[model samples]
Target chain A: MTAPAYNKPLLDVRGLTIEIETRRGPAVIVDGINLTVGKGETVGVVGESGCGKSLTMLSLVRLLPNKIKVRGGTAVFDGRDLLQMSKSELRQVRGGKIGFVFQDPMTSLNPVMRIGDQLCEPLIYHRDMKKADARKRAIELLKLVGIPGPEQRIDAYPHELSGGMRQRVMIAIGLACDPELLIADEPTTALDVTIQAQIVDLVKELRRKLGMSVVWITHDLALIAGLVDRVAVLYAGTVVEDAPVGELFKRPTHPYTRGLLASIPKLSDERASRLSSIGGTPPEPGRRPKGCPFAPRCGLAEPICHEHVPALLSFAEEPRHRVACFVAQRQMMEAA
Target chain B: MAPANLTAFVDEDPPVSLWRDAWHRLFRNKLAVAGLVIVIFLALVAMFGPWLTPYDFLTQNLEVRNQAPSLAHLFGTDDLGRDVLSRVIYGTRTAFVVAIVVTTVAVAIGVALGAIAGYYGGLLDRTIMWFTDMTMSVPNLLLVVVINASLKTPVTAWMEAQYQATLNPFYRQTVWVDFLLVFGSMALISWPPYARLVRAQVLSIRGRPYVTAARALGLTNRLIIMRYIVPNAVGPLIVSVSAGLGTAMVLESAFSFLGVGVNPPTPSWGNMISDGLRVWQHYPHLLAAPAAVLGLATVAFSFLGDGLNDALNPRGSK
Candidate 1:
């Protein structure tokens, strides 16, 4: 329900809960969370590590790791509940309707396989393209991702390519079947700064050209500033703030969002000045606070903030911006 | 379409496939090269033993019953005056056949069971591993001896009955019984290690990011195992298989020497060495010829295995 500019949503997730089996028993990792991605809209899912950002996305595709599972969720992608789909139907959606580009390009790609073969796998399986045709399409995808010498590079293994080049190959593979939604889970986390910028720009350009909805998951608030249309700020497995990109940057409502944005160092600061950062890490999954998960870390927490969790509500004057913080609600416009 | 000028940086290096790279690394190893040469030479000898041997291995001449090494017979004559060189050459054929066939059978069984156990963990994994452990726990020699002792008479009798009923010459070769028992026992014992190795390999390889990536790509588990998991897990397997071949050859010789394997007149190196052992004081050539050849094959395989281990996992090498 972010911005509501594009009403027809491509993916609408509701009350998605995930649990991990620990030594004690099953513990809730991702509490009841709601998220949605509109058709041809780019949304950035920003959160720190272990905030259930990656796990939430992985659970939608039924790719959760061993001992971790979806407790309850209804992930309706293209008007179908993905969590309840048959194995065959899930196969059609995975890499067909919703593509994923994972983190750590160096390790994510199969080292022994040729880059072309890896890129062509989904096309051959889902698109039913012949190997020869798949190969041609693979070359085109490599070119589309801006890799040099598509013909020669097609035969090269993952190790033969540089890290940035490997990531490009990964993106090309994700985009192979022309999925409706691309969920990039910290795709630029492992790249050099310049390379990260290039990849972000490339994804932005690809999103424009293909007009596919993108869920760019990252902890860096600054990286996806220019890449995403709206930003959803997650804290301890729950969305604390959801707003248009420009509005979120200009007026970060949630304490967690403000902390995240403040953490990004600005150039105008003194040469020797210390970079601002959130003092404490986000709460662990199962050990999250009974009330507001961010109350312990927030500077402006009131008595009510400690006693009860704040619901995400839109401001009366600025209906597009939604924030989940009691102190902000009382200080700012009325919650409508 | 991409700009043509953007592709200018790709001219520096040529493409090299993994197989080619592994071969290159293998050839660079001096000990491995030597092993390869000896293995190839022995394989050729095994393939063309009949043509290469100067005399029939079973032929006996009383006059030259115990001759030393000479121009006529490079390895001299045994107690029966049968040319030792011909017998050793024929022995090479038996060793290679037993080694290759047993290894192939064992590897097939091992890879299949291990891959299944690994890909689908929990009860299936425990069950297969339990079976593998049960098989491996029993002493190999004791198992083979028991099998031969218990089953040989019944199998030979069955073969005779079949021959009598059908008038089929195929069942007349009772030597098939000895081979069947030996090959079956050796393969049964040999597979457990391969199973354990491949299982461990698959368990690790399946968790890799590439495998997860493949899963995210919506590939079936079978396709993931065959194309993705198998290729990556094959390096250590190659090393294990090479070592297993040598071990199988040695095991066959031991069984043959114990009279539980290939019977007499078959010219197995083990039986020849057994025949040579008692009369070695008078004619050392009898024992030396077959023993030396067995030692050479074992050493050659070991060297090749070590070389392959290093070459396949180059990061582990200095």
Candidate 2:
């Protein structure tokens, strides 16, 4: 009775299936994906293009395009199913309890509107504050986001601001209501390396300061390596492997995860044969492999691996370290 | 809350209210400004035209009939010996009244219907649009004539019957009846285009992200349409409204020129010119003055509308 056996995860996504009604048929984009983020924990999702990582995050907030529909899922956030929430209810949760930072800062902010008005919009909508109060809060948020001279910048339009400044404004808008969870979808992907690092640091610093859970979705592994506590590796439309940050990097269990790690250039390696790139591009939506999505690129692929789909299997050595591969464990055993 | 001192952080273009910006742009268009000035001047002339004139528009003078323009009569005497200048000035008041009233009502009816149809976008949109199309299908000239003829039949018949009983032919020939006929007919035929224009504009603005953002904020649909949709769509509506004003004025004059517009003795520019054409060999001033004013009014309105379109565009500003 002295201590509780376990703590519930902040965002528990289980068996989430997303299908897009294509010209062909309902093609599954996010197939049977499951993951968790503990309270104040940062979970980084990394995958190549069209691997359903961004779609998976968008699905959580019910922000997917009209064609891509959710088939089956339980995005249990603060004891509520996001998939089942009414449009109005979903809106209340979105930008209120769960903030979203989109990738393209250029298109995200309204071109015609002043930055202050855009920031104040949510406050007036969700908080029911007076216009003056809303504006004051917006100024405070602008200042918090490190926008210079919040007083004058509030009246400026989106076009007047630089790229870095605009992204900062996007983050400020995301953190407007002091949300419990932040879903940042490739927030810094459009920016330069130095600016990307700055944004990553800002997010990490904000998470530490506010004690809010973050699901940072990105294609850049190195960026996530420094910021996130855990890593969820996605392939095609599913999470191939998930483990604590250190364990996933030290011993990547899935072939896709190993391929992703190998692709990254190391400072110690010679320039000639330094990086090992993943062969073949991600599969198109409708034409997916019968067995495993990543089996075509797997070096240890066998007849069984090609014939049967890999289930997310736990290892005896580290139960938390889950990998969806038939031959990864056997290969590890044989090598030892 | 205490009145908080609001300040802009970035020193850029001095912060001005949205309406102020619209006004500035509207005023800057040279043609629109000129048109506005002409309209204002015409409005003043129309208002004070009667007080400035000695003879009434309908007063008949057999002795001074068919006289040339001179300082004594100034604009000369008509067939009834009324001063041409006085009659012309008085007629302007009628044109201004009809143009202003028709344009206002048309914009009001059109904008309301258009906003509702475009924003809702279902059965209401289809029904309103269908009615507009049906209205538009009728030739504008035929529509105006039909409205005028319907109004005239009962009144003309009643007056003719009274004249026959009283043995008096003079009472039926009057200008007041003609002004009423023109005003009512022009208004009826001119409103459909405005309604259709507003609907199209509303449809475009409704698709914008700000409008969607307003909805997501949980603002009531009515408020969202009124506050955001209508305001954003005003840029187009304003241009339409200005252009419609000019079109309606021309339509009113065209109706008059057809003898169904303003009646004889009222001295409306259209009928005045029409009358001058009948006896152009003898009286040229009647045609020249009215034609000049009519042309000037049309040009002014067109210029103003064009100017407004340019001014309201923030990107258009230097």
TM-score, first chain, each model: 0.97, 0.94
lDDT of 1: 0.90
Candidates' lDDT values, in order?
A: 0.90, 0.78
User: Which ranges of candidate 1 are over 4 A from the true structure?
Assistant: A1-5, A333-336, B1-8
Give the worst 10-residue stretch by lDDT in candidate 2 chain A: A1-10
Per residue, candidate 1 scores C-alpha lDDT tens digits across A165-203 of 899999999999999999999999999998898899899
Q: Which digits, one per residue and each the tens of the lDDT, describe model 2 over residues B1-318?
A: 101222233455655656676788777666677888997888799889878877777787889886787877777876667677777787687678778888887777777888999988889899988988887777878876776778777888877888889968675675566666666666666778878877887887776645543443445567667777776778767877778877877777777789777766556777777777787777777676677788888888888788777777667646
Candidate 2's C-alpha lDDT?
0.78
What would the per-residue lDDT of candidate 1 be over residues B66-131, giving only the tens digit for each residue? 899999989999877889999999999999999999999999999999999998999999999999
TM-score of chain B of 1: 0.96
Q: What are the models' TM-scores?
A: 0.97, 0.77
